[model samples]
Target: MFRTPLAAALLFATPAAAQQLTPAEITRVDAIVADALASTQVPSASIAIVRDGRIVYARAYGDQGPGMKATSADAKYQIASISKQFTAAALLLLEDEGKLSLDDKVSKWVPDITGADRITVRQLLSHTAGIQDYWPQDYDFAAMEKPVTPQQILDRWAKKPLDFEPGTAWQYSNTGYVVAGMIIEKASGMKLLDYLQKKILKPLGMQAMDQDYAVGPGFPQGTHRFALGPVRPAKPAAHGWLWAAGELAMSAGDLAKWDIARIDRKILSPEDWAAQETEVKLADGSGTRYGLGVSLGQHDGTPMVEHGGEAVGFLSENVVLPEKRFAVVALVNADFGGAPGEITQGITEIFYPPMTTQPAQTIDQARDALARKLFDQLRSGTLDRALLTEDANYYFTPQASADYRDSLAPLGEPVRFAALGKPRLRGGFVNRNYEIVYQGKRLVAITYAEPGAAGKFEQFLVQPR
Candidate 1:
């Protein structure tokens, strides 16, 4: 299931009219990847950047193994959980074809699953099905060495006691996705990979992406290193063990093609894309900051849609700036550290510098003070309605207030509370993020205020760090 990185120099394949990165910028990128490789002892990495729906940069760094040739641009790595997005897309595609409904109960397709009648396909895609995760460890365990069918996995994990009531909370569960994959096969009457190829991959021209189990031989190998020890070939999970959850592998460039398609909204309808990007709300209306398959958040004030992947001997990060029509894909052949994510951060900063914020004006300072006061009020299960907009008032329902109080009160008083980064301007509101540190835990508070001399809070959200 692994392949050695090929020998190749830095590769650049961009349209003539595409935005060009300066030589210095390219040097910075190279330094970033090289530093990550040296620091983490990761064998190699493949990176690709897309701007305006065209690949602006593609390069590889390090070697195939200890003293082997340099890594090539086209070398594929197991993308791991990044494959979840593909699974989600397959289900969406079925819905588009009127073959299945995301709202359909799991019992409709696979009734043998525990609580199938109570869980919906949409909940599975969003990781809110209350299904216990079958594989939660970062490193492979002995159980992973034994091959098991998806149905067997479900029988072992999905049939267990519910982690919580469905839709009450958000927990990352690979078990939910496995069940989803099974549903796809039942609804489409095709293998999971075949359905993906016919409906998603082939249409997007992502020829380089495929399930790791199906890749057969002649591919490069991925390595694992312990401490500062020598690199050794990593042992992958048995075939079918990672089905529908972390089974896919691909070159960074091919992954970038998928990102471009997302940027251009080429595959799914606009409504479907919106559903995929919207943060899921729990029963109490608290946000999970996770969409169907991707995590939703802001990167230095710009909206970002992204996901990270980890499999034995490989790590990957994929990021998309939908508003800016930009994307970055980083794949590494070593899984011990976060080289791919670090490389992604460095590369993203080169193109989108962090926003600068002036010192808070008088009104802004008042809002900051108010944010602190509101945090305390939330801990006490109380709020000052006169200081909030009508919508905000409605948002703080009795149940929501209690939920906030129960969750925040247990954390006790914060050791530190301060503004984070700079204020963001959007939709005529001044939004700011605040960092709160408890005895041993940290949380972030997102605040939105109406712009005026006497501004009122429009939205205030608290999320765990």
Candidate 2:
């Protein structure tokens, strides 16, 4: 039978002003990760938790390879997108040294690309440059097998038309970072990797960080598991064009050390750090929750600065609770099965328990019953117009509902429909996850609502599991 993981109040003592990880906290952290490994079938992972600028707990779980056991002392994995923070930091360091300015136009360094005159270094860092993403949402997986140089990548995509006007909208673009890396080489008169090694990694004593995949020593292999069984070897991917964008390998503890440096101001100055943390706003003053390479959000009512990374076979998450002086980093050698946010949030809740008013248990029956009714109506090509919000109504029209039903038709009718986990509040919106079983296959349904008598549904989605 399925069970809610955090069903009861598994609380820890309030974090002391001095902040130390208790033995009890360490056991809980181990159990949380062990459970995740078992459920996801990921062979191994590395976890590190830092508090008050020091690593209090760091460990490796499972076997690293065919016969070798994974150990925290030496294991390293590709950190994927988390490398963006380093790229952003390098640019800021250059700015501090008066080698380059954030406001400098893209044309100042690499002028062959599109919109070079309008895009700035700061815009590239924040992903508002409007340059077409080199690896977009519809990125091709076959392209991974081919090696690419940074300039080759730019030549392929940079001269294309802008997706939108610079600073008008935000779009995540690996191309922006690639171009930024080129600018770094031009301004510093050194290779990007060499500059990083001399100016940042060596100074911070990050001895394990490396970018060359071919000459680099072997570490851990990434795996993929499609079902509940043994995982298969995923192709060893090279960073290729993702050099300064998402190409770095290091241990979780080392990553934690580098992150804690940010909080302690060991590298960038106070003003530069502030600029890194502050969100960039659009032309209309609407906020974009991204600052430089970091994503800004709130967790447990506390401010969180974080970034997640994903390459072909590795997934990484590094999060910092600046106000709490806490940070957690997790690196998993699995394609996408690892739940980094859940892992990080599990650690966060140990220090700060849920304080939001959970929707009363009495209302669950009503909510699920309504969901079933809506589900049936949607499958039968009709919709309860009163049940949907204006936005939902506009998006989930009869035609759209029919298309959705057709999408699920291949699965046959659902054999079971049950709530997957406890309903919780996120950013003031109450959301729930449910499992729908059909002919031995499982699919997921997510629904969100507004929480009172005016608690109408704002969004709903269904997808194959």
Candidate 3:
């Protein structure tokens, strides 16, 4: 998602040498994972770290089940939505063989799907198809407890009116991917999992990965309701419910193998890789910061391509820093809140320390004043377009403006509004983060300004703390 070509090239360049973690560093990582398991009371977690195309750390902590064998590095955990990347890879491979194109209309394969004629395979891959998401809740509810075919899912969800016109906005819809998976089956003349196994998994030697339905009765089961008290077994969604969206399971070690392959560009061509990594743009020409199945962002100014997954009882996180040839994978057997993601961030800090922030007093007085004014304008729903860039204006659509006003007005004026840290340069724009507190609640605002004496706000985004 880096705006400039030079910045993108620098971030995605190949690594030079392998740097193994020191013994002390390994110990620190061990402590971090152990503490998370203890504090969160999650049953078990498997972790793997890859540096310079090699696995430097692979370990598991805690028990697999009550009084059962302890979890091992090879133990499988349902990876949920992380499976979308594999589904995406399957389609890309088909495209490479001239069997299909990402631009093909969905109606070509799934002709009955509502709005299928207008939606492209590319939009479905990037979550811009405007289809309503069938599975939005975190847990497997009553309807998911029973088996249902992919066609049933599409009939129930995709046949309805679209959430918006195709590609005008970005909204995550598992239903769209389910449609894409059907297309893969039609184009490749093979089952979805069979195609993935033959084309990608087996070639990469990822033997540990398998579809959840194919696994035998001996496979480890995850638990839910553990967050509240004692562990309770989670009821996984029926076999076909997850389909192409989130049905695969694998160990952290196996996931790391896939990460290494991605770093080396093993499976897809350079052009395909670029297409997979590039952020999809909205109709208004603003970036969605999502490419295919992965979420795109930066951590401490380092580019990151990553994804997280949640099932009835499993939670997983996978992150890769292509520039540094570093990646981290964390998988937990319990659905306790965000333990895998938190553990990934904690371990990442061991390699990349956070940037130091300047004191609030050191912030430019004019910028601070302008930020406060913009905060008020956002709450009042009366933004001054002259102070904003064209992109920023596009971002503040009527619905978005009403959303900001409705959400922020209730909090009233902020008790505190100040710069979060030193402003940084990105894409030829000065980017700054600010902390805004209303009553006792906190919110963060990120602004990108065009450089000038009277800099216009190129972007202003607000999210709750």
In candidate 3, list every pair of residues with a backbone clash.
none
**lDDT, candidate 1, 252-304, per-residue tens:** 88899889888888888888888899998989999888998899988888889
Local distance difference test, candidate 3: 0.76
Residues 261-309, candidate 2: write the lDDT tens digits: 8878777788888889999998889888999999998876788899998
Reference-based lDDT, each prediction: 0.76, 0.72, 0.76
Clashing pairs in 1: 2-220, 3-219, 3-220, 3-221, 4-220, 4-221
Please, what are the lDDT tens digits per residue for candidate 3 over residues 1-465? 011212322222222223367879977887777666655556677888988779888877665554234345777788888998888888888999999899999988999988989999999989888897776544454567688888999999999888778898777778988998899999999988889889887888876454455233545567654112245566666778877888688878889989998888888887777778889998899998899888898878888899999877788999998888889999887765457987898898899877954335457678878877887898887988899876667657676677678767777777898888777543335677788877756666777777664798876767543
Model 3 residue 71 CA deviation (Å) reads 2.1
Cα lDDT for residue 40, candidate 1: 57
TM-score of 1: 0.72
- lDDT winner between candidates 2 and 3: 3
Clashes of each: 6, 1, 0
TM-score of candidate 3 to 2 decimals: 0.73
RMSD of each: 13.7, 10.0, 12.7
